[model samples]
Target: MSWWGKVAGGAFGFMLGGPLGALLGAVLGHSLDKGMKGMEGAEELGPGDRERVQTAFFTTVFSVMGRIAKADGQVSKDEIALAETVMREMDLNVEMRNTAINLFNQGKADDFPLDEVLDQFRRECHRRNTLIQMFIEIQIQAAYADGRMDGAEEQSLLHICRRLGVPEFAFRRLEKMIRAERHYAGAGRGRAAPPPSKPTLNDAYAILNVNADATDAEVKKAYRRLMSQHHPDKLVAKGLPEEMMKMATQKTHEIRQAYEQVKSARGI
Candidate 1:
């Protein structure tokens, strides 16, 4: 089966509802197959297993997307209609359709704190960079579902992408797509510039606890400190759990990148 089918099937078996179960399943299933492979021989997973992971990943991402669609005060029927259109395009089955409804309902819940909801997704996404990218892609899809991408949706997606460590170049494509959709909607928009470097090299440096003018020694110190913090194993042990190690791994990548950038700029 396809990714959505696999996730919905695995999730439908749960009594607690599909979103939470699918999210957990997607994390564990992907973690077991992707990150933890070295524990044994690391053979590739079969197609069935891969399908399960993809579905889980897609469902989790869209579930969060559903939440974000409703974040700006009200969930318009137009948005709901758009969401269904995307689902149909993806060829989701009855169970998946029901699951998506449940997830959308979950997003509409009164106590739903979007940041925490996104945080949970961030951790799960941090476990796999590709999955993180996919999650953002789905959010963009949901934002464009209503035949236009609003500024509010774009801003929310930016925040989500930043928290999930989505690279700026990847997001640029999204910006273009959104702008194009806006124009098509007769919203009267200009082309989107490249996303600003709001959370890139500088943010990475901040994560390392260093300033722009730090001495080499200070930079090294910050690098080591962040290395310790960003270490995948350390993050896994510190309640981030191994399923979400992608975030830690991304942090480590950012730390190394920051060090290199600093070294290059300083002529060290």
Candidate 2:
């Protein structure tokens, strides 16, 4: 059975015991454990469990996303649409989609345990740095869903980064990359797509996180590194769900466009 099967069937509950399990159990409308609801100490999860990690990834992502959306004290229509768009892109089935929606709503609650969830999530995927980065990227994209990062939203994101051990500098680069993706897709300024030149040389540079002055070799190196990190095959092997291949491919596609633009500009 797939990880989702195990998770949805509640077969994976024990290994995910703690807030994550409790969260999933809650959204699934089944009690994983009476004790799980108030459980903390997700620190006990180790990095060696691949099935466990995959289960945790799907569970934490939607829930934390809700937390971020509510950071500004309200969830916008666009923000809700953005979450739905992700669900569509992933091609989730009816049951899975409903669970994801419940998780998102769960995240918006007043007493959501953001820190405990992050701590456990970090540990579950400790060996998969790229996987963790992918999760952060999703959150950043959501924060930018309405085409602007609200002040409270930024603060919420930064706190997420700190809890996940992501540095401020790294967060800055990830933000630029997500913005570049919007430009590459001709998403003029918001979720609404508008036709434009689509990713000027400057946006291309931002996508790759390199400046125009960088050596051609450096540019190529960055491209290769990003492609390798975001590659769907590699990510799946590292514990990402196969359902996420479309999302991962989009990321690599954007990077490729950025790299080609940079190369073309330099006459490489």
The whole-model lDDT of each prediction reads: 0.52, 0.83
TM-score of 1: 0.48
CA shift at 157, candidate 1, in angstroms?
Answer: 1.0
Best by lDDT: 2
Runs in model 1 deviating more than 4 A are: 1-19, 22-52, 113-128, 178-268
Residue-level lDDT tens digits of model 2 in 169-242: 99999988888788776663336433445678999999888998999999999899999999999998888877
- Kindly provide the TM-score of model 2 when superposed on the true structure, using C-alpha atoms: 0.92
Worst 10 residues of 1 by lDDT: 187-196
